[model samples]
Target: MASPAGQFHPWRHIITFLVITAALYALVFFTPGSTAPKLGIDLQGGTRVTLLAKTTNGTTPSRDSMNLARDIMERRVNGSGVAGAQVQIDGSNQLVITVPGQNNLEGLTRSAQLNIRPVVARWANPAFVAQAPVTTAPSTTGPAASPSATATGTSGAASTAPSSPATATAQNEATTPATGSSTVTTASSGQGLRGEAAALLPKAASTTDASTTTTASSPSSPPPTTPATATPTGTTGTAATPTAPATVEPPASVFPAGSNPGVLTQPAGSDEAAFTTWETAAKAYANGGGPTCAQIEYFQGLDVPDKPLLACDQNGQFVYLLAQTLIPGTQISDATSGFDTQGGHGWIINVTFKADGFKTWSSYTTAHYDRTGGTNPPPDSMTAFTLDSQVLSAPVINEPITTPGTQVSGSFTQQSAKSLADSLKFGALPLAFDRQESQQVSAELGFQYLKAGLIAGGIGLLLVVVYCLVYYRLLGLITILSLFLSGGLVYAVMVLLGRWIGLSLDMAGIAGLIIAIGITADSFVVYFERIKDEVREGRTFRSSVPRGWKRAKRTILSADAVSFLSAAILYLLAVGDVKGFAFTLGLSTILDLVVVFLVTHPLVALTSKADLFSHPVWSGLGNVARAGQEHRAVAARLQSKEA
Candidate 1:
């Protein structure tokens, strides 16, 4: 190892420090769009939303599920293009989400309930669509029937359908058309019929007429004689022509009792009758009428995977009647959003399914899609992707999806697409969630808190500076310069960290920086005191500087190491605001050591070589050095007498 005197290269250390400081400042201000360190939610103000989960039955969700929910929620908030958002589970069933600045709390929370159900049918909302007049003529092959016949009772007003067994049987018999009655048949089923059926079928069915009427001079093929028609009594219509009767099948058995006992088996048969029955029941229930707040509450309480569901879109502009879930949301393995370059669809979400989900999805799509290029594919070909019982998207499957991946394409903006992709990728929550509270913090209030924190820090720094100057004399200038260097390094590091790792500084972090001042000052005082002691032992100022630093180096290392370890422990264990405090404290503690070695010790040693350091008043240790010389002379006189 080099001797203490040879180790003092004050110019080299000082020059190196200047270069580093210049580089840090360049990174802070010269980088494109670079700014000061980011501020936390408490310092910048933001919105907080609390959601309470509701059980399908009546119990709390498992801890694992709650944790999983929190993680998924965090991803969703982050994916929405919001930074520095925090998501945590409160107690057993509540989730608290905090986001910087104003956010769509409803949109963020609604994504938690991902329901992947098969779309039984879909149609545009007439209330939201332009109304076109319809021309009707008597059917040549069948009878004249009103196109709006089935639309009765499907008005916006709430209406009830037959529920009791007796009423249902009576209504079914009354609505059934006679075999020989005049009926109109179209090439398609449920086309152009108004009311419940209109709402259930795809948009393609809305433009075509249900009647089989053909003009006398028309060149089209003759209409089928056995065409089906909408029942005159406004009941659900059957197919234009019925196929052979289906074989009698056994009723579906009940699922085994468990936490969820209502999971129903897939009903057998691809017959038109089975499809018609399912469609009719679903539409009647959905179109029955507007639900009351109590009814909506009751519906929200139900999350059974096996039962048919009735829900409205997020905007509540249209209601949906969804079939039992063919593939649950949990089966989805991953989902990502991007633009469809080849297809030219605006934005799309690509979804990949697990093994079981792949099988279910492929089978469902195969059954509904028209493999033979048939003119009319079943309405069930379309699938509805819902979140919290609201349909996010409903797309028709043109071909069977045999692979594990599928894409949902629509006119989606980037933000909406990403939000949906994130929600789907995270899978569905086990329990449903209801918004409990929404709180907003104003920017002005956050600014006030930040100002107060800065003022407090400034006061503490001022007091430390005053104390250092009064006691250490000229050495106080060195202490102040070391502090300045340390502060500069810390500020640069904070800015770079914020840019790269999203490390935001809050009021608690400011407090940590303030405390670091004393820690740094203590190191300076330790080194200066050690120098005074060496001078008192008859050492020159130049020699004492290096000797003092050599002795104080080990003590400084030990003290800083302990401080760093404590800060590390606190940072690792603490959460939220406390973490910010520990992080800054730990970071500054490391910087303290750098300043001492590179700036403080080297500067002191260089200054000691100057004549000003020998003056009794200019040099803080002049008196101590004089006293030591006198004591040394007495010791020498005693030794000479002994000789």
Candidate 2:
């Protein structure tokens, strides 16, 4: 009997699948940076660096700490403005960082703690003043602190500060805030921050002019009210101290916004002991003839926000006495690097603060702005932005920044700006990491693995196809087409996912795909066997197709559900390559369901209606179809005898 009109449209399902497949293929070939699926580090030439977590107490790190470290490391990698970088935790104490191509992983494991402190005092670096300090005995010399401070305060400008010369022409344009969820764009040009954030640009000059800036050996002419002691000392540890008080007086300490005026001291709980320690270090470096700038170990315990820090600038040109952190890096919500074209700033990093941070920043800037000496702000007005133990910049508060964000501007290249921005954006890791092993994977080796995986997959597919053809005959043609369509859709999906979510295919992922071949074939066998059962019950091939599908779908769905659940469990419990395998397995299982329902069954139904394809021998149902015919003949003869 002819099928009821409009009950089911096999052509509609087939056409829809065709359209979707065509669109996916078009995107794969035509979309920029999405031409192919991303390959894992194991399949692409790269460097693998394994880092072991180190706790302060020399004990094993906890699982929660390790997991948090992994998350932060992943964020750092993403922030590095690099593509195809992977961070996976191994066991409970190790993290494996993989970067594709020739990219380096230096400094990736740093704690990356960022602190913003007020500058107490600044002077020329003693090491630079005394050229003969190199010959001095280690004990006699000051601490050989790492290069940390930048001479110019705030690398460029506070996020709300006026754009400098480079961006002066574009000053008329509004500087929009880039939030964590939004795409970063050039505030002036309103274009994506690709050149500024994604890729490295030209390097900027490292040196700042020495004339306009004051040095330890050369003091700027002070105003009439300035203190007499405010003068630079030569290369000795006896650097001059500025007349202004070194510490923020209680009752007027930097407090949170909307706090009671009666409340004194910063929220960091700076105590007299911390101040005494800071004073000792500062006095010894100054008149006490203590360790000079070069002898101060800035990296040791400088991250303590409650204590004052003594450190040197990156160029070793200036040493700074910084107060306790005014705005912790943790309060920063977003940081993006972009060029300030109209402001003439080469490259600047814009930092957006959280709600509390915004109010604190506003109050701090307002207080300092009021203390400015006419056009130039005093050292007390400067704020030092430090990453780890190094001072990145100490820019002066030019104005009371009531804005929600601020930018760090300086002599920066695209690469340096992006690096700083990424660090600030990702925040600090909970624990420190020491690199235990680092190795480079050669392209030749990756190629070998890729070839082997392909060969294995190809062989598996061939075996499945051969089995189907031998057992099902002409019906096997339907199976072949279904597999082809399924593979095509999966391939296209992988490419799209690679572009969108940074999914990469590895050796284990290939194993998952190979297994999918078996999965798809199993569905085919189940459905075909159901149709054979219907034929054995004396139903015609045309009627058996739809009825068989109804019964087989439930079984196929149950089996696929089990497989998917297993993959999901494995994905959650496993790490590294095992997770990749689970991910691909789950993805393939879902696609199998789609193919069986929309592509496979529809084709079978259409074929059953054709005379040539439905013949018992040609249909690969010779015995079953013949038995159904015999049963029907017997039933008709019985009816005739009864009449």
Highest-TM-score candidate: 2
Q: Please provide, for model 1 over 1-643, each residue's C-alpha lDDT reduced to its tens digit, 9 standing for 90 to 100.
A: 7568645578899899899889988988898534688787877877889999866545888898788778777766654221457898899899998876566665565544555676564433333332223222233332332222232121221111111001111110111112211111111221111111122343323221221111122224332222121222222333222112113321222111111222111223345455455456445433323232122223442455555655444333344557777787788788877866654445667777889988887787777753322234345654666655555554335455556766555446676777777778765555567788999965544888899988998898888889888777788888988998898899899888875545778777888999999899989989988998898897788888878998899989999999999999997787667877888998999999989998998889888888885565777776777788888989999999999
In model 2, state the lDDT of residue 69: 85
Superposed Cα deviation of residue 554, candidate 1 (Å): 1.3
Query: What 10-residue stretch in candidate 2 is worst by lDDT?
Result: 195-204
In candidate 1, position 544 carries an lDDT of 85
C-alpha local distance difference test of each model:
0.59, 0.62
- The candidate that wins on lDDT is 2
Candidate 2 Cα misplacement greater than 4 A, ranges: 1-7, 32-45, 48-101, 106-110, 114-302, 307-427, 430-439, 443-449, 496-502, 537-540, 631-643
TM-score of each: 0.50, 0.56
- Candidate 2 achieves a global lDDT of 0.62
Q: Candidate 2 on 489-518: residue-level lDDT in tens?
A: 999999888765457787888899989889
